[model samples]
Target: MTKKLFYNDAYQTSFDTQVVKNDKDEEGRDYVVLEETAFYPTGGGQPFDEGTLNEIRVDNVEEVDGEVRHYVAEPLDASTVNGVVDWARRFDHMQQHSGQHILSAIMQDEFGMATLSFHLGAEIVSIDLDATDLTEETLEKAEERVNEVIRDNRPIETKWMTVDESNQYPLRKKLAVDEAVRLVVIPDVDYNGCGGTHPRSTGEVQMIKLLGWSRQKKIVRLEFVCGNRVLEQLGNKHKVLNGIKGLMKRPEEALEQEVSSFIKESKQKDKQLAEQMAQLLEYEARDLASTAGEAAGVPVIERVYENRTIKTLQDLGKKIVEQTPSGIVVLVSEQKDQLQYVLAQGANCSGNMKEAAEKVMPLIEAKGGGKPNFVQGGGTKAIAADAFAERLREAALETVE
Candidate 1:
C-alpha cells in the first residue's frame, strides 16, 4: 500500500520519497510506487492532484484502500526523487471544499437537512440539500454562522483510529470503514470521516456563500462559490451592469427605475396605436366590400390585403359581418411569412359557413373551424389564397342557393 502523505498534512507542499518500482509498459514509462506523496487522490467528490515528481510530471493520482497510485506520463530515473504539489490548484480546491463543509454543517445544524450530492464543475459548484422551502431569515442565520466558523480560525485536525474507536465519535454520517479510518475534524464546528485534502485551519476557507436554491424531488439544490471564485463572480457582475447603463444612457444607480418607467410608457403607446389602427381597418374593409357588389340580398365581400396578421383579418371580418348582416364575408391576408383565411356569416346566412370552411380548408393544407356561422383557420405560405377563396365560393353557393 502506498503511504498517503496528503491525509496527514494538507499544507505539505513538498516531499522526498524513494522509487520502489519503475518500468516501460504500454503507457510509455512511469514509476510504480513512491515511499511518500503529497498529491491527494481523486475521491470524496474532490478532484485528483497534479504536480511534478523530480523533473517528471505526475499526470494522475488515485486511491485504493489507503494506497495512493500515481500515474506518470513519462519515466524518470529510478532513484530518490523530490515531489512538488501544484499549490495554486490545491489551494483553490481547499478553499472551495472547506467552504462547502462549513455550509453543509450549518444547514444541518439549523434545519436538519442532509446534503444529498455535491459537484465542483468547471463553471460552478453546487450542493443538494434534502429540504423544501427555506426562509430569508434562515438563510441569513446560516450564512452568519458559517462565516463565524471561518473567522474562528480553528485548527483543522486529521487523525487515524481503529474502526471501533472511530465509531465512538459523533459523525455527520455513518462511518463506512474496514481497517483504519481517517477523520477530519473542524474543532467544534464539524467532525466527519473523510479521505480528502483540506485547509490547515477554518480561516483559510476565506468565505462561504449560499447563492441560491431550487427545488428537486423533495430537496433544495443550492449554487454557491467561495474565495477567489466569489471575487471573480462579483467582478463580472459589475462589468455587465456598467455595460447595460452605457447602452441605456442612464447612470448605473438609476438603471432599475429608468427601465421600469420606460416599460410602462412603451406599453401605453402600444395600446393607443392599436385602437387607431382598428378604426382605420374598419373603414378600409367597408370600401373594399362596396367594390365587390351584392349577391342575392347580402354583400359578398371578398378581398385580400398585405401586411396583416390572422388576428387582424378576423377582427376586420367580424366588424364587416356585423355591419352588413345579410351575406357572407371572406377575408384573406398574407404577411411576409404566412397566410390566413377568415369567413364570417350573419345570423340570416343561407349556408353553413363552418362546413364550407372545413371542405375548403384541407385543399390548402390549412385548418378552419367555426361556431355554425363564423369559421377561421390558417396555414403556411404554401397555401394559395385564390384557390382557397374559389373553393369557398363554390361551397357557399351550393349551401345558399
Candidate 2:
C-alpha cells in the first residue's frame, strides 16, 4: 500500500517522494505509484486531487488493488520527484467535504434523515437523502441548523483506532472497513468514519447555502454549495441582476414592480395587435372575393402565398366565404420545405371543395379532411406551387359543375 501523506497533513501542498513503480491501467494509460504521496485518490464520494508530479500534470488519482496510482500527462523519467498539489482545488474540496459532513450530521441528528449518497459536482454538491419528500419549511430549517454549526467554529479531529476502540464513540454509520478504521470527530456533534480530506475546523467551511431539493427516483436529491462557491454564485447572480436592472432602467428596489408592470403592458399590447390583424385579414378576404375569376358560371378565388400558416389560411377562407355567398375559395401556401392548400366555398355554392381536394391530394401525397364545401391539408412539395395552383383551378372548376 502507498503511504498517503494527506492522512497525516491534509493541508500539505508540496511533498518529496520516490517513484516505486511506473504502471499502466487496463487501457494502457500511464500512471506512477510513489512510495509516499500527498495526492488524494478518488474515493469516499470525494474527487481525486489534481496537481503535478515532477512538474508533469497529474490528471487523476485512484486506488487500484492496494496502490494509489497517479495518472499523469506523461510518464515520469526521474525516480526522485517532487509533487505539488493545486492548493485552490484542494482547499475548495476540503471546504465542501467538511460542509457536507456538518450538514449530514445535522440532518441525521435533528431531522432524522439519512444521507444515502453524496456527490461533489463542478459547480455544486448534492446529497441524496433516504426520504423521497422534502418540504420548503424542512429544507429551510436544515439550512439554518447547518450554518449555525459552521458559525460555531468547532474543532474537527480524527482518530486512528482499531475495531474495539471505535466502539467507544457514537458513529453515524456502520464501519465499512475492519482494519485501519479512521473516524472523523466533531467534538460532541458528530463521529463518522471518513477517508476524505477536510479542514481542521467547521468555521473554515465559511458558510453552506442550500440551492434546492427535488424528488429523484425514491430519494430526495438536495443541491448546495459551500465556502468560496457561495461567493462565486452570489457574484454571478449579482451580475445577472445588474444586467436586468439596466435593461429595464429601474433601480434594484423597484425592479420587481417594473417587471410586473412591463409584463402587464406587453400582454395588453399583444391583445390589441391580434384584434387589428383580424380586422385587416377580414378586409383582405372581402377584397379578394369581390375580384375573383369566373369558372363554370361561378366565382373562383385563387391565391398563392409564401410561408403563411394553415391557421391564417383557414381564418381567411372562412371570411371570404362569409362575404361572397356564391364563390369558391382555393388557397395555396408554399412553405420553405412543404406545400399547404385550403379548399373552401360559400353556403350558396354547389361546388364540392372536398372532391376537388381529393383529386389534388394524390398529386401532392397530402393528407386532409372536411365537409362538401370545406377541406384543408398540406404535405411535401411533390409539385411546384404554381403548377399546384393550376391543377387546383382545374379541379375547382370541374367540381363547380
Candidate 3:
C-alpha cells in the first residue's frame, strides 16, 4: 500500500519518494509507482490531483482496488524522484470537500436529513438534502452553526477501527471495512467513514458560507463555498456592486430601491416609445408605397434598416404590405451575431410566402416563416452584413419572378 502523504498534511505540496514498482504494461511502455505520494486520487466527488512526477506530467490519478494509480505522460527512473502537487487546485478541493462534510453533517443532525448527493464542480460545490422546506432562517442558522464550529477550533481526529467498533459510534455514513475502517471525526460535529482528505482542525476550515438553495422533487439542493472561496466570492461581489453603484450614481446601500424604481419607470417609458415608433413606421410605409414597382403586375418594394429587433421588422413589413395595393415588401436588418428578414405580400403576389421562405432559407441556413401573406427569418450561419444583404436581395427577386 502506498503511503498517503495528503492524509498527514492537507497543505503538503512537494515531496520526494522512492519508486517502489517500476515496470511496463501490455503495450510494453515503462511506468513507475512511488512508495509515497502527496497526490489526492479522484474520489468522493472531488477531482484528481494535477502536478508533476519527476518533471513528467501527471495526467490522471486514480485509486483502484486499494492502489493509487498515477497515469503520467512518461515513465521515470525506479529511483528517488520529486513529486509536486498543484497547491491551488489541491487546496480548493480540500476547502470544498471539508466544507461539504461539515454542511452534510449539520443537515443530518439538525434536520434529520441525509446528504443524498454531493458534487464538487468547477464553478461551485453542491449538496442535495433529503429534507424539504428549508427556509432562509434555517439556512442562516446552519451557516452560523457551521461557522461556530470553525471558531471553536476543535481538534479533528482520524482513526482506523473495525466495523463493529465504528457501528457503535454516531457515524454519518455506514463504514465500509474489510480489515479496517478509516473514520474522520470532527470533535462532536461529525464522524464519517471516508477516505477523502480533510483539514486538521475545525478552525483550519476558515469559513463556511451558504450561497443559496433550490428544491426539486422533495430534495433541497444547497450551493455554497468554504475557506478561500468565501473570500473570493466576497471580492467578486464587492467589485460588481461597486460598478453597479457607479452606473446608477448612487451608493451601494441605496441601490436596491433605486434599481427597483428605475426598472419600473423604464418599463413605462419603453411602452410609450414603442407606440410612437410604430406610428412613425406606419407613416414611412405609406411613403414607401410610391416606390413600389410591378413585375408581371405584382408590385415589389425592398427596404433596409440599420439595426432593429425582429419584432419591429416584422411589424413594419406587415403594415407596409397591408397598406400597399399589390406590393411585396422585403425588410432586412442585421444585428449582432444575426441577420433578420421579414417578407410580406399584399393581394398581388401570386406565390406562397411559406414555400418561398422554405426554398430560400435553406440556401443561407436560416429558419422561420408564416402563411402566404408574411414570412420572417434569420440566417443561422455567421454571415457578414453585406453577404446577408446580398442573399436577401436574391431571395426577394426569386419571389418576384
Candidate 4:
C-alpha cells in the first residue's frame, strides 16, 4: 500500500515524492502512482484534490487497484516531482466537511434526526435527514446550536482505532470499515467514522448557514453553505437583487413587494388583451363569410395563412360555419416546416367534410378524421397549404354533388 501523507496532515499543501509506477488507464490516459502522496482522492462524498505534479496538471486522483493513481493531463517523465495541493479548494472542502460533522451531530442529538446521506456539492452542501417533520423552527435552532459548537472552537481529533477500542466512544454512526476504524471526534461533541479531510478545529469551519430544506419521499434534504461559501452565496444573491432593484426602481427592502405587485398587474393586462383579441377574431370571421365562393349548393370559405395556430384556425372555421348555415369552411396555416388545418360545415349541409379531408391527406401525408360535417388535423409541409386547400375545395364540391 502506498503511504498516505494527507491522512495525517490535512493542512499539508506540498510534498516531494517519487513516481513508483507510470501506467495508462483503460482510456489510454497516462497516470502515475506515487511512493506517497498528500493529494486526497475522491471518496467519502468529498471530491478529489486538484493541483499539479511537477507543474503538470493532475486532472484526477483515485485509489485504483490498491494504488492511489494520479491521472495527469500529460505523462510525468520526471522520477522525482513536487506535488502541490490547491489550498483554496482543499481548505473549502475542509470547512464544509467539518461543518457537516457538527451540523449532523446536532441534528441527531437535538432533533432525533439521523442523517441518511450527505453530499458536499460544488456550490452548496446538503444532508438528507431521516426526519419527515422538519420545520423552519427546528432548522433555526439547529443552526444556532451548530454555530455555538463552532464558536466553542472544539478540537477535531482523528485517530485509528481497533473495533474494540472504537466502542469506548459513543459514535453518531456505525463504522463502515471494521478492521482499521478511523474516527473523527469533536472532543465531547461528536464522534463519527469518516475518511474525508477536515479543518483543525470547529472554529476553522467559520459558520453553518441552513439555506432551506425540502421533503424528498420520507427524508428531508437540507441545503446550506459554510465558511466562505456563505459569503459567496450572499454576494451572488445581492447582485441579482441589485439588478432587479434597478429595473423595478424600488429600494432593496421593498423589492419583493414591488415584484409581487408587478406580476399581478402583468397578469391582468394579459387577460384584457386576450378578451380584445377574441372580439377581433369574431369580426374577422364575418369578413371571411362575406367573400365565400359557391361550391355545389353550399357557400365555401377557405383561407391559408402562415404561423397561425391550429386552435385559432379551428375556432375561426367553426365560427364561420355557425354564422352561415349550409356553409363550408376550410382553414389551413403553415407552421414552420408543417401545416395545420380545420374543416367545418354548418347544419343542413350534406357535404362530407371527413371525405374531403381524406382526399387531400395523402398529398400532405396527413391523418385527420371527423364527423360528416367537421374534421381537423395537421401534418408535415410535404405540399404547400394553399395547394392543399384547393384540393379540399374540389373534393368538397364532389362530395356535396
| Top-scoring candidate (TM-score) | 4
Q: lDDT scores for all predictions?
A: 0.78, 0.91, 0.80, 0.89
Give a tens-digit lDDT track for model 2, residues 248-296: 8888999999989999999999999999989999999989977988877
Off by over 4 Å in 2: 264-401
**Per-prediction TM-score:** 0.62, 0.71, 0.80, 0.82
Cα RMSD to the true fold for all candidates: 7.7, 6.0, 4.3, 4.1
- Model 1 global lDDT (CA atoms, 0 to 1): 0.78
Q: Best by lDDT, which number? A: 2
lDDT of 4 by residue, 1-401 (tens): 77888889999989998889999989999999999999999988899999999999989999987999999999789899899999999999999999998998889988999898899999999999998867779989999999999999999999898978998999887776769788899997899888889888999999989999998998899998899999999899889988998898888889889999999999999999988988888999999988888866679898999999877887788788877888888888998888888888888777788988888888888877778788998898998779988888888777874
* Superposed Cα deviation of residue 323, candidate 2 (Å): 15
List model 3 lDDT by residue over 172-256, tens digit each: 8765566788888887899888777777787778998888889888988999988888899999999999999889999777999
Q: Candidate 1: list runs displaced more than 4 Å.
A: 20-33, 55-59, 64-67, 71-81, 259-401
Candidate 1 local lDDT, 1-401, one digit each (tens): 66777777787879999887665446464545777778888878788778988867888776654556677777677678899999888888888888888888889977798887887755467888989877788888888898899899988888889878877777888877788888888876778888777888988888777787778888888888877788888899899998889889998779999989999999999999998998998897677656655656556888776767778888888887776677788877776766687888866676788878777776667876777678888876676666667677667656674
After TM-score superposition, the amount by which residue 91's alpha carbon in candidate 2 deviates from its true location, in angstroms, is: 0.7
